[model samples]
Target: MNVEDAPEGVEEPQILPLDAWHRARGGRMVPFAGYLMPVQYEGIMAEHLWTRESAGLFDVSHMGQLVFTHDGDIATVVRALESVLPGDVAGLGDGRMRYSLLLNEEGGILDDLMVTRRGSEIYMVVNGATKYDDIGHLLDALPDDVTMNLQDEQALLAVQGPKAVDALARLVPGVEALVFMTAGAFDWNGHALWISRSGYTGEDGFEVSIPAEAAAAFADALCAEPEVKPIGLGARDSLRLEAGLPLYGHDLDPETTPVMADLGFALSKRRREAADFAGAQRILAEREAGPAVKRVGLLVTGRQPVREGASVVAEDGAVIGRVTSGGFAPTLGAAIAMAYVPAELAAPGSGVRLVQRGKVHEATVAAMPFVPHRYVRASASPQTPSKAGA
Candidate 1:
């Protein structure tokens, strides 16, 4: 969901394995995260709606896929990872994944990532823009016995929506057995694939990591399903925004802490009690006293969307906070945004005044995921689906 233009004097944007495939489907190419990727094909609105109702395929090969191994036992690698990340790495069951934050010594967030315990090796997926820095950080923090492998020859694809499982299960055969936050290795056309029942979109989904050479064929096979259609980055952004998922460079940064970003769930209870991991002291202290600013969702009163960089202002026009992500949520049929505001004003239904381009807009602090999440968790009751954040 993080899209940006290449700055002046930057190197040429690289192409994904499916670059030609996207163009063949009329995908509009654009620069994002140092890569030439599709922003849209048919259209953002139609693609978004289709995804919510049926299935949408997204090309997310730009994300960094990493595998960590150790000469000794897996515990050695887990300890090394737990030292830098604020998650209980050792407690993760096999094939289970956890969302975590990479924090600086001063408690600022470097990035948010997903870590999965896969067999003897640990697998991780990081934001593309910060993957290199993350690799460097891990190498520096890890002991010499632990080895990190950057999976450069892999392509990541996500199939998301209510019917994603129906479409994906037909190809992979056993992927439907994977519950949320679980992954497994499977064979497709003789190519090994690591498939996870997880995705950026709030809907039930699967992310498939396949060999680069086989990516195009795999994509074609998925799209061949009547319930599936290829989606672009434009719809990806709006879907995540509606789901209340934070974008790294925009909603999170080096200056933002987990508590300030409303991501305390990333800080495991055991890790918090043990006070191990980077910035534990500061993070735990903030958890006790509360952060000065808290991230909250906003429901704009009008149809026009308020974009990022809009200022949250007081009645007297003094800037109080800033909007990180904003857009018109097609599912909710309303303009929504995520912003950091004073702790006292973080409660739901709190009045907020935003100014964009010198025009004042009225909004109210609201609960996140303007649209409800529909994850198929193992523990979800049949009467009510899970509303858990992705």
Candidate 2:
């Protein structure tokens, strides 16, 4: 399909380069992140479980990749970025990445994204559904000298799970030297690519940004690794939940501030001290006094899982909030959900109930990362103190 250059009004929802390949492998296509992606290859439940035990490949080409460069001053351009984002961009070094949020005037989260400093340039990846508006916001708020380029030629693939590290190490030797949130360029079969030791699954994995034309071929190569299987959005969602990672539209939005979402840590010590980012006033205020409601993980007692938009209630039956993201955690072998409830009820072991289909299932507030993280990070040394880059 000649969709890369298709006119705005004439195009259907974009398809990743691996669309046909996924279909050939029994993938069940579904619309997600504004792209027609595979929701399941073999089956949702089986795929979800496989990713927990072995590596799974995901075509995330629908995500928005943006490149930014400074014309005269890099720091000056970064400060402009800080003006709208709650991240210490000025402190990020080359080859490092940080998680951050785009905040509104009231400190509400507009979107959550990743920012990486690649040599003199910066790269950003935002949720596909929010990419259009996110780019417009950055263009309007950032310094005039800062140029933003949508990387329309790039396609992103995520390989995640326990075996991810070993699978990638075969192609990109010494990647084990990289830490979480760090990335570098590598060459595979004559194809140049950017690989980041980052993923939403909380597993030891890499997100490879490849040229649109090379995405499918590289994915096929990785699949050649005996442990690697083609995963779909269905498994991706479940894996992230098992990791307790938040989903943008479900766990966060323009209505929920960072502090409210339990993501105040994204606003680093420097950004907090500098106090210059957008909605800094409101965000800091919430951090000081505590948010009225807080996001917390829920562990259901029953086998059936409660999903997004399910009402949360007090033990006495008073509706307090709603479940944001949830599913049966294959790794945990239990039903888990993330929800927001009154701050007083946010603590671990606090009793709460998930009301689904008119039946209230007993659950409780709990610490997240319902499953353990197996992230591979850089080792520390005297010269590389705290080598696990921020």
Clashing pairs in 1: none
CA lDDT of 225 in candidate 1? 97
Q: What lDDT tens digits, residue by residue, belong to model 2 across residues 1-390?
A: 001221243236777788898998889898886789999988878888888789999988888888777764567667667788878888899888999899888788888899998877788898888887787677667767677788878889998877887898898787767778899988888888898988887777789998889888788888999989999998888888877788889999999998888887798898898888888888899999999999899999888989898999776778889999988987778899999999998999998888987888889788877876777656632122121211
Off by over 4 Å in 2: 1-11, 380-390
Which digits, one per residue and each the tens of the lDDT, describe model 1 over residues 6-62?
A: 134446888999999999999999999888999999999999999999999999998
Candidate 1 lDDT trough over 10 residues, lowest sum: 1-10
- How big is the positional error of residue 196 in model 2, measured in Å on the Cα after superposition? 0.7
Q: What C-alpha lDDT do the candidate models reach, one value each? A: 0.90, 0.82
| RMSD after CA superposition, every candidate | 3.7, 3.9
**Per model, how many backbone clashes are there?**
0, 1
Quick one: how many clashes does candidate 2 have? 1
lDDT, residue 59, model 2: 86
